[model samples]
Target: MQRYFIAPEQFGQHTVTITGEDAHHLLKVMRMKAGDEIMVCDGLGRSVLARLTSLEAKSAEADIIAEMETNGEPMWKVTVAQSLPKGDKLETVIQKCTEIGAAAFVPFQSERSIVQYDGKKEEKRQQRWAKIAKEAAEQAHRSIIPEVSQVMSWKQLLLRMAEFDLVLFCYEKEGAAEGSGIADVLAAFRNTHDSSREAAILLVVGPEGGFTVHEADEALAGGARLAGLGPRILRTETAAMVGLTCLMYESKEMGGA
Candidate 1:
C-alpha cells in the first residue's frame, strides 16, 4: 500500500485529511478513488490503515481502518552531521541515509568544504532536502520522517557535540592505534548506556577533501570519539551511509535476533 504522511492536526479520531501534493498524488498521479485503502502516518511514529471516504480536486479524506504496527525505525536515534560536499552529493546523502534509518541530518561547513554556504538560497535548499527525506521515509515504510537541519559552521557543529550521547567522528587520517573501529566504539557505548533507552548518536563525516588535522583535533577535544569505518577510505558521500549501516548492524537493528 502507498503511504502518505499527514500532520497531527489533519488526523482526527477516525479520519484523516490529505491535502497539498499528497492529495494530488493520490487523486491524479495514483488515480486513487473513494474506498481505496492506503496507509497514513502522523510522522510522529503512528500509522493507520485508512480507506478513502472522499476525493476532490485538491483534497481527499480517509476513514481510519486500523492502527498499524511499524518497526522500520532504529532503536537508536543516529543523526548524520555531514560536512557540505560539492554539487548535489548532499542530496544523495540525505536520501540514502534517511533510507538507512538516520534520525536527522546536520549539514556543516568544514574547513575543507568546497561548497560555500548561500544564505539567500538556504530555505529553498532545506525544503528540497526535506522533501527528499520525506519521500525516502515513505518508501522505506518509516513511521517518522527524518529532519534536515539548516547548514551550520564547523564551530557551531562542534559546540552541538554536547547534545548527543556519543559523537563518532569519521576521520580518514585517524590511524588504527589512534581511533577505535566503529564496532568497538559502538560496543563500548552499548555496554555503558541502558539498552532499553534510546541513545542519541552523532556520526560526523567530513567533506570530499576530508577534515584538516586541526579540525579533527578540535573535535576530539570536544569529547567526540574518533572512529574509523574500515581499512578502505570511503568518499564523503559514502561515509555516512556506511557508518550508519555499521551502527544498525552492531545495534542488532539489522541482522541480529
Candidate 2:
C-alpha cells in the first residue's frame, strides 16, 4: 500500500487531511478514489490505516481506520554529524542515512572541509536536504522524516556533542591504526543500552580529506569515541552510511531480541 506522511496539525478527530503535493499525487498520479485504501503517517511514529473519504485535483481527505505505532524505527536515536562534503555528496548522505534510520543530521564545518557554508548557501542547502529527506523517508516506509539542522562551526559541533549519551567518530587515521574497529565500538554501545531504557547514539563523519589530527584529538577529548569503519578507506558519504548500518543492525536488530 502507498504511504504518506502528514504533519500533526493535519490530523484531528478520527480523520486527517493531506494537502499540497500529497493531495495532487494521490489524485492525479496514484488515481486513488474516495474508497481506496492508503496508509498515512503522522511524522511522529504513528501510522494509520486510512480509507480515502474524498478526493479532488488538489486536495484529499482520508478517514483513519486503525492507528498503530511504528515498530521499524531503531531502538537507539542515531544522529549523524557530518562535515560538509564537496558537490552533491551531502544530498546523497542525507537521503541514504534517512532511509537507514538516522534520527537527525547536523552538517558542520571543519578545518579540512572543502565546502564552506556561508549564510546564503547554508539556507539553500538545508531546504534542499529537507526535500530529499522527505522523499527518501516515504520511499523507505519511514514514519518520520529526519531533520536537517542548520550549519554549525566546529566549536558549535563540540558543544552539541555533549547532549548525546554516546558519540562515535569514524576517524579513519586513528581507528585504522589502532585495533578499535566500528563493529567493536558498536558492540560495546549495544551492551550498554537496555531495551527497557531510552538511549541515543551520535556518529560523526568527516569529509573527503577527513578529520585532521587536531580535530580528532578535540573530538576524542570531548567524549566522541574514535572508531574505524574497516581496512579500506570510505568516502565521506559512504562512511556515514556504513557506520549507521552497523549501528542500526546492532542496536535495533540484535538488541531488540
Candidate 3:
C-alpha cells in the first residue's frame, strides 16, 4: 500500500487531510481519487488505513479506518553522533542510517573533522538532511522519522551524550586492544541495564581523519565506551552504521529471539 505522512493537525478524530505537494501527487501523479485506500502515518507510531473521501486542488481528505503501531521501529532509541566528513558524506550517512533504524543523528565537528559548519550552510544542510531522513524512513516503512540535529561543538555533543544510558565510540585502536571490542562492551551493557527502566544508546563515529588522541580521551572520560569495530578500519560514513547494526543485533532488537 502507498503510504503518506500527515501532520498532527491534519490527523483529526477520524480523518486525514493531505495537503500541498502530497495532495497534488495523489490527485495528479498517482491519479488517486475518492474511494482510494491508502496508508497514513503521523511518523510517531500512529499508522492507519484511510480511504480517500474528497480531492481538492490543494488537499485531499480521507476517512481513517484502522490504526496500529508499526513494527519497523527499534525497541530503544539509537542516536548516532557523527563527526563531519568531507563532501556529501554526511547526507549518505543520514540516508542509510535512517533506513537501518537509527532513531536520531547528530553531526559534530571534531579537531580532525574535514568539514566546517558555517551558520548559513549548517541551516541548509540540516534541512537537506531532514528531508533525506524523512524520505528514507518512508521508503523503509518506518513509523518514526529520524531527526537530524544541528551541527554541534565538542562540548554540546558531550552534553547530549549525558542523556543516553550508554554511549559507544567506534575506536580503531581499541580493536587491537584486549577486551574492548564492541560486542564485549555491548554485552556487558545489556546485562547491566535496568529492565525496570528505559534506555537509549548513543553511537559516536569519528571523521575521515578520525578522532585525535585528546578527543578520544575526552569521550572516554565522558563515559562513552570506545568499542572497536573490527580488525579492519571502516570509513567515517561506514563506522556508525556498522556500530549501530552490531548494537541492535546484540540487544536482540534486530530479529533475535
lDDT preference between candidates 1 and 2, better one: 1
| Model 2 per-residue lDDT tens digits across residues 1-257 | 89898898889789989998899999999988989999898777888999999988777888889987687677789999999999899899999999898899999999999887789676777789988988889898998889999988999999888899888988887556656898787778767767677678889999899989999899999999999988898989999999999888777554556
Quote the RMSD, in angstroms, for model 1: 1.3
Error of 3 at 84 (Å): 1.0
* Pairs that collide, model 2: none
Superposition-based RMSD of candidate 2 using all C-alpha atoms, in angstroms: 1.6
Tell me how candidate 3 scores on lDDT: 0.86
Which one is best on lDDT? Answer: 1
TM-score result, candidate 2: 0.94
- The candidate, 1 or 3, that scores higher on TM-score is 1
Please give the ranking of all candidate structures by lDDT, highest first, separated by commas. 1, 2, 3
Q: Please give the lDDT score at residue 159 for candidate 2.
A: 89
In model 3, the worst 10-residue window by lDDT is 248-257
TM-score of 1: 0.96
- Estimate the TM-score of every prediction: 0.96, 0.94, 0.94
| Per-residue lDDT of 181 in model 2 | 91
Runs of candidate 2 exceeding 4 Å displacement: 252-257
